[model samples]
Target: MPATSYLRRLCACLALGLLVGCRPEPAKPLDQQLYVWQRQWRPAHEQALAESRADFSTLRVLALQAQPQAGWSRALVDLSRLKADGRPVIAVVRLDGQLPALDLDVARTQIGQMLADWQAAGLNPSGLEIDHDSASARLAGYTDFLLKLREQLPPGLKLSITALPAWLDSPQLPALLRAVDSSVLQVHAVSNPRLGLFDPVQARKWAERWSHVTERPFYLALPAYGMALLPDTGGVPLVESETPLNRGGERRELLADPQQLADLGHQLRDKPPAHLAGLIWFRLPLPGDRRAWSLTTLAAVARGDALSGRWLVELSSQDGLYDISLVNVGNLDQALPPRVELSAEQCDGVDGLSGYTLQALPQHLVFNRQSSARVAAGGRRALGWARCIRIDQGAWHVYP
Candidate 1:
């Protein structure tokens, strides 16, 4: 063929390839709309806020720094309105005393009154969420306070608490989880450097461990907003402002973005561990140009169509050295098929893993250790839901 003819054919083939690669497009404007959520109310995000209808049934707000009677009063009104519209509310009560921390008796009395006041104002919360940065050292006192608060809490009310991520691995965690009705493990990995980097792989491990240990519904509090890096005069992660609130106060730069948040959320959806209610985007009134991005994501989630299904596969050195458990959200259980064979490539060249055999449980796709060895060393694997799994097998397919 002539050179000109050959070049023309190549161009034609390239265009055809591009067309074929594109998947069927999702809904246009409706699917593309995003919600903006922030810690403080601003006229800027008003449009986004009005448009957002993010599902709050599984959402809980913990207003920690809210103080002053008037501020508290306004917050109560907002909570009341939200509850009237049918949304769950959780007010994080901070202890006023130091050292031994106000006597649990006094603490309980004060918090109870606060709750009563809110209830009287026509804002009936599902329950209270106890939060304290100093809660680590004051675990004993805090635990006592929570236990008492739980007892004093009226019937039909629920109790939950915001736990610092550092405390998740604490020896006291078991007892702490035991005391609360639910736990919102503040796994703010982005904000803390000491724990480690933002490894979604490791996050899967933390989620699995917490779910297994706590055996309670918990909120995955994520930093929808990014952190500003402090100039290191010395060899330390220094900043004019340290905490998220402080960072915002100082007007520092942000590290995470909307695209990043979407990536993180999708990663969690795949094998949503047991009792994994949903995600909480830190505190609201988000500061920055990304406000719309956050709100849009929330609205998508609220619509109950946030694309969810991704897996966390961890491969280790030796078979017995580590565990490769998968939290199954594909609805694969004993009632369905006992065993489904996944090929090596399907297993993604995992040397040890043969296939997956789901348990009777609906929320776990755990991989046995012996079976996991087939997966390649130092490699993790995940399976995305290409299509939705049917709720149940039909009558025409009834077994013998």
Candidate 2:
């Protein structure tokens, strides 16, 4: 075949899902969305949502969840505030993946009541998203449930599902995708905890392959949070997110790197899959939500802004006692620096808390980070305190 003929052939097959070798066509910029995964809405949410207004355009709020032993657990969301926000809202219903079987009737009834209450309260949800992590072999039954739910829903209201990449190999996957208006392909924390969160290479592969299986538009559910894995005698570590575990021991912390995710977003924009729509960040961060990204960092990543963290050591004194803190003045979230040192004379006492250790030397007091914990943009961390006579104010240094 001539070069011109081959070029035409490639263009003709670009949008078709028939060949895995076909390259994706250039796509429009993806829209940004967020998952409000908190079960309880508080006054803090009002501020978090307001600050996120400029970046995210849609909200997927947790409406209800199915608990195996306790039946249904509904979220206490502020519907009036949601309506006031004026963004497209998608109500989410979560069914625990661990459940042996789903009771269709109970699910339908609970869903109906929730939707009715929302509608009756004058806040209309733009869509419904079902978040269930069913085993690959059970997708047939799951399909039936979704199909029935779709038929019973009000007309023109969208229905979507939280899809896992593990379903890619299952033959029944196509039918499941067909039952919904869209899907949120969750790419973060889907694998073993040891592998870390948010793999850009694997994520791209999943999105590209998923596009071949579904004709409907789908969003990628990326992580904007962290998790703590506590050692368990049963082999699998106890995974903690948003909620705390009373059992406290040495644990491994995994955080989704903002720079890495931002780079992936850029790649997807440059070469996006067919029918790929947007990104839905998992669980928006609020004040004191230590496991999540700050809104400043999240917004910067969403907009593909430059990332750089600026840390300054400022010491406040009262008599001979001095308080030390590191303040981040830049837009990026950064890992704790290796060491911070301050020149002092005749130090009587010194201390460091959190992830830092304090050392009192002959001429300087050193604060060393003991872990890879990070500080957020525009955030502050206390490096503990010190009591000394005649400390040099101009000799503090922070080492990266």
Candidate 3:
């Protein structure tokens, strides 16, 4: 090759390298943590806490609540047990609606006293979080309250707040952001589905818009729980229970789809802004909390893994009686057929499920699936039982 030709090729390669370096680098993945908001401390939660400690960098626990009467309702966490593993725990102090309306000095003193009590209990938390859903009208008051609370907090301890999305547009947002060490933008709520809870599209838009305006780092609080909406006498949807409803009024379970969560994770990783801190899950999963996501699903979403649907059917016998159950072991709800038929050669009698209707066929027992009995994700329902006084075979057939 000619020397000039080699030189030209080298120059082109150098130019390409420069262009690549000038282009912006991809955003790093968000380092999100989990929030434990169980009002009643349970022994089982310890395991969940420990597991969370292993997976995430930090855990935020609801430690106290400022009641409407200007008193504190403290959560009883076994600090020794929680801190034994040496993971960081941020104590969250939630202020009820009335606190923002109280006298500034009085509220300040009460908050300070709670911090002192926590220290007295030998829990020197790494951070203290204030959770208040301050009304739109109380933005200034809430801002002032936080500023005062910050001054009372011990030096070297971080102060954080759970912020509503609307606050991102408030005029006082900048001052509030400056007052706190960090903020968690709670992007999920139990509202109507015109816009679903934990909508990734809206979440990404919020993160992009607010991250540029806020001076302090902010984390996104995602939902890991479900809500059951029941209709009232006036045909309005009311929150009936946190758990999935299996009987009575019309119910809708609002759960964040795992795919949407994963997509959001990708968006944050691709172009996360300077003020975008990370993500924090609303509540950790408990063993018997049917409305909450299972630990497996939560972990999968955090890791940005694809979630698949699963169905499980089991039959067990005791004292000449057999019980059938249908379980959803996946992270998405599943629909069942209108009726399921069960048959066995030696089955003597069949009892209908209390919440569903049953029809006897010539060779099988048919159980109808009530509209309300549709199984939710991570939900379990009893299908009915059979009395088998004698059995020539240990086989049963189920048809959907």
Top TM-score hit: 2
- Pairs of residues at least 3 apart in sequence or in different chains that clash in candidate 3: none
Highest lDDT: give the candidate number: 2
Report backbone clashes per prediction: 27, 0, 0
lDDT of 2 by residue, 1-400 (tens): 9999999888878746556657565478899999998888989999899999989999999999987787798999998988889899999999999888988888888998999999988888989999999999999999999998888888999999999999999999999999999999999999998788779899999999999999999999999899989999888888888999999788788889888988998998888898999999988898778899988999898998888888888889999999989888999988789999989999999899778999999999999889777788988899989999967878888896
- Candidate 2 residue 13 Cα shift, in angstroms, is 33
lDDT of 1 by residue, 122-146 (tens): 8776667766554466677667767
TM-scores of the candidates are: 0.53, 0.87, 0.78
What C-alpha lDDT, on a 0 to 100 scale, does residue 371 get in candidate 2? 73
What residue runs in model 3 are displaced by over 4 Å at the alpha carbon?
Answer: 1-26, 100-104, 120-122, 190-199, 228-256, 316-323, 329-347, 352-365, 371-382, 387-400
Model 1, residue 177: what's the lDDT?
84
For model 1, how many clashes?
Answer: 27
Question: Looking at candidate 2, what is the lDDT of residue 248?
Answer: 73
Between candidates 2 and 3, the TM-score winner? 2
Candidate 3 lDDT, 290-378, residue by residue in tens: 66777767777787777776666567788988787767777655555466655554566777674666665555666786655335567
